[model samples]
Target: MSDVLQSAFNAFLEELKNSESLIRLTVSTLLLILVVAVSRFLLRRFIRRNIQSSEMRRRWLIQLRNILLIVLVLGLVVIWGHELRTFALSMVAIAVALVIATKELILCVSGALIKGGARSFNIGDRIQVKEFRGDVIDQNLLTTTILEVGPGRSMQQRSGRMVVLPNSLFASEAVINESYSQDFVLHTFSVPFLRQHEWRPAKQKLLELAQKHSEPYLEQAKRHFARLSYRTGLEQPVVEPRVTIQLQCAEELHLIVRLPTKEHDRNQTEQAILAELFADDDYLGDYLPRV
Candidate 1:
């Protein structure tokens, strides 16, 4: 068995020695790939060690990985430049026919390129394109899939459907990113009061309740807004949870409550606020009047 194995190894080495250029190129390509991969891994480790706590570190890591991959691709082209060009030229007619035959595939690939360049949305982002609305669960060069949420009354709840959308959709549709700046969104609901009732107390109490429930998300928004403003050159909007008294009609005084909430938690936060409203004596007896 040892003699047979030695013979086989010697024959393989002899074959490789006979094709010196091919062996060299093959080994060099593997080495280049390994070097690129190791550098990427080391860069990731360094970032994790030093900048793991940084807010924008994840974006930076992704960018660095892309740059390394691009460099590896260019390196391969330089190493096998002549052979690749000749092979590509020979296959040009066939490639053209394939592209035309796979029209949808080409469109999807182009759309993916456009989507990446446009920075339309990212994974875990809740987006609405056309009538499809959901959280992005997966994306590929050919398709972008979402976990479908909401159908009728259950607006925020998942509908147990995974929507597989072709990346091509972004070329012709508007994408509404619900929580682009932060993981939270401004959610508002109103409570009713009689016009004869003193409104200030209700407003004050609601604001307090909203602030209490919304404090964490507000803090997160503040951090995200710092980055968002720096990138977009847009002024930060007032994120302090507040209550506004709006007269919906002559017959009704609407105590409008607004707060920052996680996109998934908006309904629950609204329900909790509503439940707490009547729990307070001021909100319940606002219309009881002067006795």
Candidate 2:
């Protein structure tokens, strides 16, 4: 009985020693698992320590961390126990297979990574990607979620349904990130003016109203623009609120008010300006342009 038990134990050890792939895969997996687990633990702790608000941004970061960890573990498994030549050949084969099997998916993921790494946009940013314009609510490996905006149900109201767009769209599409780098975007509202109404006074009044109503955003925009200018070696953008007058139809002028404010606050700002104008009723007087 003792001899049989010893023989069985010896045979088990011998199998383990001879199974090169199994041994290699097991060791590599264990090592990678440990490294990823420890690194992620540390990273999460650091993020919690530094980040003030634990919002959707933090959730996104956590998701990113998990993805990175998985990639790292898979990479280590591929590299371990394989000779350099073998690893290179394997990688080439895998790449070829991926191209053949999932070209579109690979493109989408690559585009998303590029967009995120380049800081082209972020969650909560108001952006127009191609024809879809909305506030970005969620961004993942393959797709981004947008809350639609525009005219009718498409324009003003936040569509309760979220739009999931492929990240690859950004590569071939023009992306306008309204809140990129800065919290405020320039919003322009145009009002028609009759030729009989004096344009200068209307412009002055519009400028004053914009400045008064958008004071907080104007100040914030100034600081944001200043920093961006210094970093990019561009002229500091003028954030002081103002209105421009344009002669349009022979019968009317266009009063264009440019205000610095959060993109999401555009409707509110427009309503406020109009309310103020209607309440005073003295700026344009009896010469108000036909609506």
Candidate 3:
């Protein structure tokens, strides 16, 4: 067995020795390896001597390794340029197959590029992509990590869940940047009541509560929306507190309250309004559903 293996290896070497392209490839591979290895060694030595902090040294080493890898890849492409040209048709077919196999990965990268080029959202920006809505905690080429903001939008608070979404989703789904308004936003929430209840008084009370809670920031929000409209050429939206009535069904109705509040105070402001409205049932006593 040893003798047979030795003979096979010798024959393989002899065949390689005779082929000019094979010889060039072999020589180029060794030369590239030697250059990368030496460069890496020198880089490590310099970094270790000059960089005192362990974290800085680690970062430098990582960057150096990445540069060396890029150099090795470029070197191989340059050395195999002629051979690659000879197999251009085969390469094209292989490339197509690879693309099909890695379609999601390609989409993810393309999505990331599109997001960056468009400046769709940044870290800390609350965004809604289809059913998933959250604040972007981290983002990279393949995925985005968000602190999940809802079991549903009715609760404008984090659900303590971390959702990692493929960047590819950005390509297919519309990304709504909720934080685009910056400091102040016109937020809306629903207050459900029985259809038999007095919705008129409830509506008036809700408007009063919303207006009271939003009074401090109402002027600021108006100014912000004014600037936003001027810059974006969009018609300025109404920033005052308002209540719109809607019938959820024959038995139930909803009072949708639209109010301007600080971006981070949606839940708090809603809670405050509801708390005051339902505190003693005196304000909405007739409207409250009986147990």
Candidate 4:
């Protein structure tokens, strides 16, 4: 009985030693590939079904899913055939080669991850980073896409043209999020008048119009500002609608109306204000130059 047991154990060891390791590795690799493919397909479907917001879904599908899938595949590969030492050395060599060969890409991707993780901006948010100002349309591992907006030709308006910018630029540049924390941002409009006109009535009327137009946003902004101030141990400024008149070009009176406005509605609000101003000549007649 002892000889039979020894013989069986030795046969088992010999079989393991003489087994075609390459064949095993190939089979394992094929299985890993198949698992990854199926997982990706199922994950995509699950994400689509579970994520309600289109923007959030796009981000998860494009960025998060790919990262998880890669990690899983790598883990399976290491477990299937490679020894820990061999895997560690291979990974270190790959990392070194990646650092040397794709330094810029690595920096950009890493910067993007940091920025995204910090919640610096989100899709549809208006952001100004460096010379590029636009609505964020897409964010990826290395780049953040913008639907450019502004005056110059370089400023691609919301005309669907996308500008892809490397995320590393944020490290060196100041980033301004127009719709940060709050949906509405302050929009100021300037109306020029002759210096001789009494500005009080016009200013009052402008303030009233601004309040009327932005009543909802003003209320919300005031509450948000108050909370923020309290949290930061600062005194909150009195939240009221107001207009300031400034002397410009030595002769013209610049009546500036500052009000809360949605980013997309800024142009519309400006046009509406101008239309209202023109429609009521009596209100604006005091500011007109004397013939």
The lDDT leader among the candidates is: 3
**Model 1, stretches more than 4 Å misplaced?**
1-101, 152-154, 189-205, 216-220, 244-256, 262-264, 278-291
Ordered from best to worst lDDT, the candidate numbers read 3, 1, 2, 4
Best by TM-score: 3
Per-model C-alpha RMSD: 19.7, 19.6, 15.3, 20.2
Q: In terms of TM-score, which candidate is stronger, 1 or 2?
A: 2
| Whole-model lDDT, model 4 | 0.73
TM-scores of the models, in the given order? 0.52, 0.56, 0.68, 0.55
- What count of clashes does model 3 give? 0
State each model's CA lDDT, in order. 0.79, 0.74, 0.86, 0.73
C-alpha-based local distance difference test score of model 1? 0.79
The digit string of per-residue lDDT tens for model 2 on 1-291 reads 345445555655565567667666777778777777787778777777777877955895779687877788567757663443444554566567657778788889888877877788878887887778888889989999998877442244566767889999876777887666555667778877787766667677788889898886677777877887898898877777778878887888888888787767878888788788657554555676645
The regions of model 3 sitting more than 4 angstroms off are 1-86, 282-291
Error of 1 at 212 (Å): 2.0
Writing each residue's lDDT as its tens digit, candidate 4 over 1-291 gives 345445555655565567678577667778777777788889889999999999999998998667867777676658554444544554565567657777798789778877877788889888888767888888888899998887542222465567899988875677888766455556766877776666666677777778887886778877777886787688876556668878877778888887777667877777776677656554435457645
Model 2 misplacement above 4 A? 1-101, 152-159, 194-201, 216-220, 247-252, 262-264, 280-291
After superposition of all CA atoms, the RMSD between model 3 and the true structure is 15.3
- Cα lDDT of model 2 overall? 0.74
lDDT of 3 by residue, 191-220 (tens): 888866666787888999998998987788
